[model samples]
Each structure stands twice: as C-alpha cells, then as structure tokens.
Target: MKKRLLILPLLVITVLLAGCIGDGTKNMEQQTELKGVLKLDGSTTVYPIAKTAAEEFMKLHPAVTIDVQQSSTGEGLVKFLAGETDISDATRAPKDNEYAEAQRKGMKLHMTVISNDAVGIIVHTSNPVSDLTTAQLKAIYFDGTITDWSQLTNGTKKGKINIYNTDPKISGTAELFNTKIAGSADKPYVAGTTIIHPTPKMIPTIKDDPDGLAYTPVNWINNEVKMVKVNGVAPTQKTILDTSYLLSRKMYMITDGAPKGLNREFISYILSGDGQSIVQKEGFIPVT
Candidate 1:
C-alpha cells in the first residue's frame, strides 16, 4: 500500500513537471512567432531602402507582413497625421506644420535619420556642361534667371533650357530642393517648367531630351543621365557622408512616438549593421 501511494505521488509530480515544460514550450513558440503587419508609406526616393529592409526583415520573421506604399512625402505625412500608417519615410526633415498637425492630434512624432542622400542635378549624357554652382542652379530652377544653355555653355550650345521639377506640394525632393537651393519651400519653381510626379520619371524624361535638366536623389542617377557636379563637388557617398556635398540631405523614418514592440524591433533592425548594408546596396549613405 505504501509503494502504491509513493508511485501515485511520483506520477503526479511527473505530470506536473510535464505540464510546466509544455507551457514553457508554448510560450517560446509564441515569442518566436513574430506575427504582425507593418505599414510603411512615404517618399518614393526612400522607397528602395524601406522595401529592401522590409524584404530582408520578412525573411527573418516570416509571420510579419510589411506593406510599403510609394507616395510623395507630403502625402505620407498626411496619412501619418491621420493615424493610418505605422511609419513615414522622408527624404527630408519634417516641416513645422507637420509637427503642429501631429501635436494637434495629441500624437508624439519621432524622426529617425536613416540615411544621407544628395540632390543630384541631372542632364542628358550628351550635354557638354558638366558642373553647376548653387547660384546657377538656383537661377535656373528658382528665378528663371538663366533660361538658355548658351548662357551657361558660353555660346557652345544655343537652345532654350528645358527644366523639369518634381511637384513641390507632394514631393520631398522638391521640398528639399526648394528649401536648400531656393531658401524657402514657399518659393515656386520657374514658370514654364514641367512638373513630374515620382522621382524615377525624372531620369528618363531627362535622358530622352537633349536639353533636359532636373534635380533628383543621387541614387536615381544612371548612365542614361549624367549627374552634374554641384559647387565643384560630385555627389558621391563619401562627400555626402562627410557633409561636404552642397546638396546633401538626411533621410528619415518618422514614428508617432517612441517605437515599441515590433515597431521598435523593425526600426532597430533597420539601424543595425545588416540593415545599413542594404542601405549602401540601395545607393544611399548609411547613417552609421
């Protein structure tokens, strides 16, 4: 009878231990299953980096879904203000009005500098002019002060300049250009200039036109279009990282407040070494 009682106690203890182990295993599984949807929207210029990082992050956590959208930076800020997105990507810093709007909603906005990018002055490959000063760029795009290639090319070229610009109301690149070159976001582009939407369109638009000129992020510059030197310095990763390039700007990912849970993890991953590698591969200078 004593042996039977001792055996019953041993069985109960074993079952209790097994139950504890099972609970622990389930908890571990729950922790390992990183399941959530991450919504990202913002600058098409910053899209490549966000997309690449999203892709890599998903590989690490299969249950996580990231929906990345390409809209102009201004629109992204609008969505963020509406509490529709978890993250907003921007090629420039948030404007005062953006901060005010977020504050009006009682939401705390946090901006993370993810990368450094340069505003590239692009032209057709055949264009003989290889460089432009900040003054020349400002006059060309802002004041319409320089209207023809002959004015810049010293009579070597004779044609009306075809200036293109991203819509300042929507595009972060245009806002950056306006603020950096023209000294104000309220400043308008030169009259008669064509306004493009996404930054990528600027590449082919300039490539096909012999007299084409536009400003875009340096990553978008390809062999089809030649990127002109600004202030006697080319927009290289080194120059941009060192802040020696005249047209460089910091890229950002803004959250509503201090990132928590998966949002924190995702942003942490992006700032990590692996994520910065993707940044460099995507042709932007890593913040690190």
Candidate 2:
C-alpha cells in the first residue's frame, strides 16, 4: 500500500513537469521573432518616448533590434524621404512638401497619434516670472526685444533674460514659434542671448542656469525648472486636452509605408491601454 502511494505521487509530479515544459515551448513558438533591424529618427520632443517604446518592445522580441536616432523634425523628414529609417517620431504631421516627396518615391506614410503634449515655457526656478502673457513671450523670443528680465516688466529691477531655443532649421517647436510668434517665415527671433540647438539641450541649460528661459514639452518639465503660465493659462494636461493651452502640440509615429512586424506591433501597443499607462507615467498625455 505504501509503495502504491509513492508511485501515484511520482506520476502526479511527472505530469506537472510535462505541462510546464509544454507551456514553455508553446510560448516560445507563439512569439513572433522579429529579426531585422528597425530604424527611427525625428523630433527630439518625440525621441525619448520612441526610444522607450523601442526598448520595451525589443525586450519581448529579443531577436529584434531597434535603433533610435535624434534628428530635428525637418532633418527627420529628409531622412524618411531618403528611405533611411523605417519610422519617424514627429511633433507635427508631415508637410505638403514631405507628402509630395513621399508620393514621388512611391512610399506612403502611416501616421499614428501617440500623445498630446503642451509646449511649456520654462525658466530657472530662481526666476520670479511665473506667468507670461502671450504677447510678452512673443516679444521676448520672436520680436528680438525684451532682452532683460527688467525689460519684461517695462524697466523693473529684474536681471537680464537669457533666452534659449531649439534651432528653427531642425525643430518643429521652432516651426510652432514661426507660426505662433513670428507669423512669417522670415521673422527673426526675439532679441536675447540665443542658445539654439535641439530641445534636449535647451531644457537642460534652462534648468541649470537661473537666468535662462526656454520652451519644451510639458513632459520634459520637472522640479528642476518652473513652467511659466502663458496669457494667464498654465501648460498642463488639463489645459492641453481642453485646448486652453496656447503652446501645445500632438506627437505622432510615422512609418515609411504601411507598418509591418514589430514596428506595427509597437505602435499598436502604444495605443493600447498598457502603452498609455507608460505614457502617463512618463509625464505625457495619452492619446485616448
């Protein structure tokens, strides 16, 4: 009787082990092994989110390699037009010229809205200017005036305003500036100490220096800097989604053509609930 009981226990153990092995094998086989390298490039505004998505997607599909590169929006469009990348992370939709170029090359762009983010005007925490009128912001950055903090208040006892911005040649944020501030392509930047580069660079410099001011996506704003209110309205998720914020934009994922493989899957994942969770945690607003 004892021997029979022992044999029965051994049989149960063997069955359990077999079930585990079968599940493991099935999981391995069910995984769509993405092998070829996928390339993405575009707006620095969209770069961090794209890079994060690529990293997470690659972990599930170990055979896939996603390469994310930073280029300003216009340059990204150029590369996409040249067929250098499979994906383009853009803060703005492709322009008419870009669409014409893609059509000429027999490539169609597949656009997926990733998130809604406000473009925040940031200043060093030390700056007392917590709110700025849109006219003041335009005068400071686009009209080439408002060179000093004192100038912002019409000769108050404030220090000089150190202005920084992303290069208009490469950034969609700059394009926004051109539209909202300059109202013309040939309009010059508001006069101040210009620190022009990518958005990544602009945000950091503004944070580290107490006298500096710059603009970037709200997701990028942290305790390191303070977001200045525009026309008495603050840049926040509530303001952006409600269309109350003046400095806001939509982020997008652009594919060279109809997406396939991990690229398609990854975008789908971002649009899914799981993906939007990451977006919110990362300080960006989910498209949904």
Candidate 3:
C-alpha cells in the first residue's frame, strides 16, 4: 500500500510539471510568431515612459519591434492621421481642430488612457522664488509683470526671468501653459524667454540656467531642476491624482482606431495593473 501511494504521488508531480512546461512553450510560440514594427511618436512627456515600456515588451517578444520618437503632440497627431504610425502618445485628447482634420483625411482614432501627467513649472535650483499664485504666474509669463526673481521673492539675484517652454504649436505642455499661465492664446514670449523644441530639451537647459522657469510634464523634471509651488500648493502625486493640481494633464495613447496584433496586446498591458505600476515607478500617475 505504501508503494502504491508513492506511485500516485509521482504521477501527480509529473502531470503538474507537464502543465507548466506546456504553458511556457505556448508563450514562447506566441512570442516567436508575433511580428510587426509598432511605430509610435509624440509628446516628449510620454516618451520616456512609453520608451521604457517598449524596451520591456521587446524582451518578452523579441520578434516584435517598437519605435518611439518625440515629435510633439501635434506632429504625432498629423502622423497618426496620415497613417504613418500605429500609435501616437499624447498628453491631451484630440482638439476640435485635430478631430476635424482627421475626419477630413478619412482617419479614425481610438484613445487609450495610459497615465496622468502634472504639468509643472520648474525653476533653477539657484532661484529663490518658491511659490506663485495663478495671477502672478500669468503676469510674469504673459503680461510681463514680474520681470525678475527679486520681484517675486527676496532673492539675492535681481536678474530678469528667463522662461523655457515647449514648442507652442506642437506640444500639449504649451497648451496647458498657455491656458493656465497665459490665460489667453495670444501670449507673447516674455522678454528674455526662449522656446525650446522637442520639450525634452528643457530638462538640460533648466539645469544649466540659474534664473530659468520652464513648464513640462512632471515626469520629465529631472533632479537638476526644482519644481515650484503653484498658489502655495506643490505638485505631488496625491495632488495630481486628486485633481488638486491645476496644471495637471491627462495622458493618452492615440491610435488609428482599435489596434491589433502586438500593438493591441501591448496597449492592453499598459492598461493592466502591472503596466500601470511601471508608470507610477517613473513618477507619473497610472491610468488604472
């Protein structure tokens, strides 16, 4: 009877191992057969997060290739509408003009929420200005009221404020900045301000300048720059998730309608719990 019990236990173990091997083999087959290069671009803000995800996805499915680029939100939309890419990552939804343009071109778009982004104004660490009200921000950047750091704070330096911002026409970061800080569409570049392109460029510029104020997606704010408090409220994950941060922006994956193949599968993963964890880890709010 003991020998018979031993044989039964051995059979159970063998069957369990076989099941495990079968599942792994199935996954391998799926990976090997998965094909197609997913071309994606847009929102320099979403670039790092999406690029990281693409790199991770490639590890599991080596047969598939993904290309992520930063061409700003408007350029991405144009590319998506032209069917030049399979995915367009953006910080905002399609504007009325963009939607009309897509319709005119006979393009259909489907949106997938990937994450939430806090549009934050970062200043050089050397600047003493810590907090700003919405009205003050508007006056400084648009109306040219507060021209120097000393006007806003009792800092040692009394130099003119240098503003660095994303491309006004192509970036959602610019759109938010225009709406919240400029309070109008006709904002002239403040004197001593520079408009940076590709959005990511602001990271290094802000780090190098001593009197610069720039706005970007919070995830892109490297340790080199210090985030400023708006109306005495700092930009935090809690504030962003709760919609307390007035400058926060929603991020999305703009596709040429419902996607298929690995593109669809990967997007599904992004909306999954595991994928969202990656977003949170990268300092952005997860859509899940």
Candidate 4:
C-alpha cells in the first residue's frame, strides 16, 4: 500500500461586512472573499497609520491587498491625481490648486479626515511664558525677531532664549511648523542663530537649558517641558479637534472623487474604533 499525502485547501469562509464607516468588521469576525489591491502613497506622518490599517484590514479580508507609500503631502496628491494610486495619505487638507487640477482632469477630490496633529510650542518648566499669537510665532520661528523671553509680553521669565528647532528635512513637526507658522520652510528663521537638531533630544535640551524653546508633537510634551499656547489656545485634543489650536493640522486620505469598493472599505476601517485606536497608537489624535 502507498502512503497518501493530504493537502488542506487554503481559505474558506463567509463574508460579513460591517455597518457604516468606522464600524470595521467587529460585528463579524469571519473572513471575506473581497479581493483586489489598494495603492496609497504620501505623507510619511500618515504612512504608519495607513499601513497599520491596511495590515489589519487584510487580516480580516485575506483576499484583499493594500500598498502604502510615503512622500511629501504635495507629491502624494500629484500621484493621486495622475491615477498612480487609489488613495493618498496626506498630513494636510487638499490645497486649492490641487482641487483645481483635479477638476481639470474632470475629477473632484473627496477628503476624509483621519486624524489631527498639533505642534506644541514647548519651553522649560521654569519659563513663565503662557501663550504666543500666530504672528508672534512667525516672528520667532520665521523672522526670528523675539530672541529673548522678555519680549513675549505674556509674563516674566526674562532671559536670553536659547532657540532650538528640528530640521524640517527630517522632522514632520518641523515641516508642519514651517508651513503653519513660518509660512515657508525654504525661507525659515533668519532672525536668530538657533540650535538645530532632531526631535529626540529636544526635551533634554530644553530640560538642561532653562531658557530653551522648541516645538514637538503635543503628545511628546510632558512634565519635562512646558507646552505653551498658540493664540491663547492650548494644544489639547479638544483644541485640535475644534481647529482652535493654531499649530494643529488635519491628516487626510483623499480619493479622485468619491471612494468606492476597496478604497471605501479601507478608509471606513481606519475611521472605525479599531482603526482610530491605530491612529492613537501612532501618536496622532483620532478624529472620531
């Protein structure tokens, strides 16, 4: 008698789709026959969140595939408009000319707000500064006018401020600061001879230098560094969600027009409870 080898078939399951955007598949844990590849690119900041969403989504719908890539937000929109990708991960909202360009191609863009990121203007715990206006922020980070803490007009922690900034080339928070406060990263901060480094040591630097000032993700701000307000609004979840925080920006996933099929399902998963949890895990403020 010959020995027989038995091979089990790979995947066999019923499809159970969830209700509404952000519901995901919690209602039904079974696998789906859903198949096809989804391509997404842009915004390194949003890359992690999007990638995680793709990974978890594919787990449930094993037949489906999702590809996520990272680039500048502007570049991502360009690719999205060119039909190179199914979705674009963006750290900022769709720009006016981008919308126009999409219209020129006879396609209207649809935006889905996935998360919010805010750059907290941090200072030493000893610093008495409380808030900074947007214009004052430009003067400090862009124009480099207010070199000393005494010029802040908020309170008295008078000293020569040791300005520290993260390089925009590698720091998403820096890039965001450039666009939101500095107006242009290309012509940023000519006002002072400041120390420039990456984000890892920002808190330590500020901790050591009593008169230090810098910016980092709102979440990074803790007992070590005091997070000051922008335009009298503190960088908090409520302020970020309300757009009251000046340095706050929304992260988005865009489609050529309305998202459908895989595009729709993928984004919906991200907006769902499971997906929003991923957003929080990635250091982003969840929108829902």
Whole-model lDDT values for every prediction: 0.89, 0.79, 0.82, 0.77
Candidate 3 wrong stretches, greater than 4 Å: 1-33, 154-157
Could you give the C-alpha RMSD of every candidate to the true structure, in order shown?
Answer: 2.2, 5.5, 6.1, 9.9
Instruction: List the lowest-lDDT window of 10 residues for candidate 1.
Output: 90-99
Q: List the residue pairs that clash in candidate 1.
A: none
Model 1 regions more than 4 Å off = 1-19
lDDT of 4 by residue, 1-288 (tens): 122222222111112222332355643433455789999987766888998999999998888989888875777888888989999887666666778999899988898899888878888887777787889877766776777777884446678777788656445567778887867755556645465543546778888888888887665566888888888888778888888887888888998777898888889999999999999998889888
Q: Which 10 consecutive positions of candidate 3 have the poorest summed lDDT?
A: 183-192
TM-score per candidate, chains pooled: 0.92, 0.82, 0.83, 0.68
Best by TM-score: 1
Which prediction has more favorable TM-score, 2 or 3? 3
lDDT of 3 by residue, 32-93 (tens): 68677899998878888888888888887787799999888888988888888889989877
lDDT of 1 by residue, 1-288 (tens): 999999999999999999999999999998888889999999998999999999999999999999999898999989988988999998777788888988889988888888889889999998999999989999998888899999999999889999998887778889878887889888978789998888889998998999989998888888999988988999887888787888889988989888887888888998999999998999888888
> For model 1, what is the error of residue 15's alpha carbon versus the real structure, in angstroms, after optimal superposition?
7.8
Candidate 2's clash total is: 5
Question: What residue runs in model 4 are displaced by over 4 Å at the alpha carbon?
Answer: 1-32, 124-130, 150-212, 219-226
